[model samples]
Target: MFKEMKLLKPSWITALLVIVLSLLSIQNYRVLPAKEDIIFAAIHWHGPVLLTQTLLLCLIAWQVVSFRKIRFLVAIRGKDEVIQKNLLKLMTMEVIGYFILFDGSYLLTGHPIFSKGPVIIGILMLVLRMVLVWFLGLLLITTYTAPYPGLILLGVLVVNLFYHYVIEMNFLLIQYSQTYDPLWKAFNLNR
Candidate 1:
């Protein structure tokens, strides 16, 4: 199974980029309130983020299993016709997974963990975030790869930067005020 699997350099580069950027974003979030409250906020924010990270890992596992199964079947059948179809499916899954994992990391950077919600609600939030991130990734990738689409990619990147820095920050501020601020305050004051 390991012998049959190959990782592309570009995909690895993209993954690294996503991870570094996500970490930077999370660090920015830590400073949103104050240096003294960083630990309090991190404790409050880690639970749901950890859950979502687990789900994302599960998705990657499923993709790997599916790829291995398809490869095994191809080996047993020894058919050329099916190989192309299966390989295409595998590649598509890999690309989709790459984009989802990257974008989901970005989403996790700003999202606060819910302390009192039902487990189902937390799961739903994770799913919704993943879906939204996947959609955004798809749109950006599509535009970037379209014929003579550099201009479109640039436009999309500008908008994405605006949304991330301006719109999402404001949204997070509003959300944290309603949901996370009291918990953070209590946690810090008690400590």
Candidate 2:
């Protein structure tokens, strides 16, 4: 029965999980006034993480999917000549998994980033992040066939830098003050 059913290689899931785990990581610390109590920070969790590093994660996902071995590469070996025909399916699955796992963790932990957000905004935040990552993965993979891949990579780097400094889009994961959060009441949905 196991053989009859399709199973993905463990490595693909491993690589996808690594990205999710990294994003969901908590940054714990204590301020001078709260020295005795460790605080699980929302902004501190991923605030300092550079956008370039996020792009690197996308690149890593691309590289992992490009692996040739049985463990890293499977489920795309169709009779058709196009080896990457299932690339969209694979990327969509990875993004959905990334959203569910990370957001689910946020929901359970009551992280201020997730807990203090309105239901609609919270859902939108997850969706936007996943869409950007999915697009980046596809962009990175497209470069493989380009003649001057380095130039394209450099251009991508510039855009990421612009987004990091100018646009300043950080997955809407902000740390709202406990007492002043207008959306705090919406946290019931999280629980």
Candidate 3:
């Protein structure tokens, strides 16, 4: 019913991409948004709350979804732990770079993304977008590497449907941002 997989053995190119992107974070966003601004800054994509939730979910989903849906135990069944750890390191680096670039860009340039229509509905819609895009990424990556990736990709979608973490995290982000948005920034920080 199941076979061992070493799906996350990241290639040198992937590592290079992670390294390059992390280097970019060293630019623009040097530190947290000064002091009190950190609170208001929490709503933006770079905010700690949102990023933490997303990271935790991604980690959890990687194992939980794979185990339940794909029927394979990653990091446990074999020599997968080392590969998983390396992939995690690179992923973490990339995420940090993402935060720096987006937040710093906002601070230096202006708001990069926003809700197009209303507030709550638009936020949920954005959540849907994230969920779909993430699923697509999972599909594409799995398809490229593993010959029997359809079931794994389907597992990702099933997991998303069941846990709905994408919506939950985005909702929390919006609420936190709304709660902490400074008068000067207003809705600008709710990216």
Candidate 4:
């Protein structure tokens, strides 16, 4: 079963696409509302949240996919510790990035987390990412495998589509302004 599962590898392009979309969406959100308003309203909108969540999930998927490529136990000697350490590092980075980008700052963004729908969704995504990572690790360890790439890809597509619909419904599309938005300008701390 494990060997069968290892056949699947996530598409690097898709992962990169998710990250790019999420970052662009977040940039859009951060620029829309008045600069003086609370940052939460700007950052925690539906579209931005969905994009961030998708990006994090894609990162997690990539981590597991990479792990799946290596043989669980190599016949060659003395490579086990190095491989294990590297895997641990990758998992740690994914978990940390997921939390920081999706959860940690999110809680601080809105007025008292629960007061806003977007914040709630952000929290949910954060928890979901954590749970997903745990399950991915478990699958890697116990099954020495994961679901087929096709299944994972299908899931990603479904989630992406649902996210797109939600963003559209919320009218949270990323619209680039003709001029650089003040938020971006300020971030650059120029003019």
**Residue pairs with backbone atoms closer than 3 Å in model 1 (clashes):** none
RMSD of each: 11.4, 9.5, 11.5, 11.9
Evaluation by lDDT, superior candidate among 2 and 3: 2
**Model 3, range 27-134, lDDT digits (tens) per residue?**
334553443232233334343333333443344335333533442443255644444454454444444444454345545634323322235654454445444434
Best-performing candidate as measured by TM-score: 2
User: Could you give candidate 4's per-residue lDDT for residues 54-155 as a string of tens digits?
Assistant: 555555555546555454444244454554455555445544554455444444444344332344454554455356544444333322244565476456
What value of lDDT does candidate 3 attain over all alpha carbons? Answer: 0.42
Task: Report the number of clashing residue pairs per model.
Answer: 0, 0, 0, 1
TM-score of 1: 0.35
Checking candidate 4 for backbone clashes, the offending pairs are: 40-109
Model 2, 58-132: lDDT tens per residue? 544455334333322233444222334344455456556655554555545533443444556545544554566
The residue-level lDDT of candidate 2 at 129 comes to 46
Q: Tens digits of per-residue lDDT for model 1 on 1-191?
A: 43343431225643564454445435545344432232223234452234333343333333334444445455666643443344344434544554455445534555444444444544554454445444433443333124544454455445544544454334543353434455566778787
Candidate 3: regions farther than 4 A off:
1-78, 110-191
Q: What are the runs in model 4 whose C-alpha is more than 4 Å off?
A: 1-25, 31-44, 48-50, 67-89, 102-147, 156-191
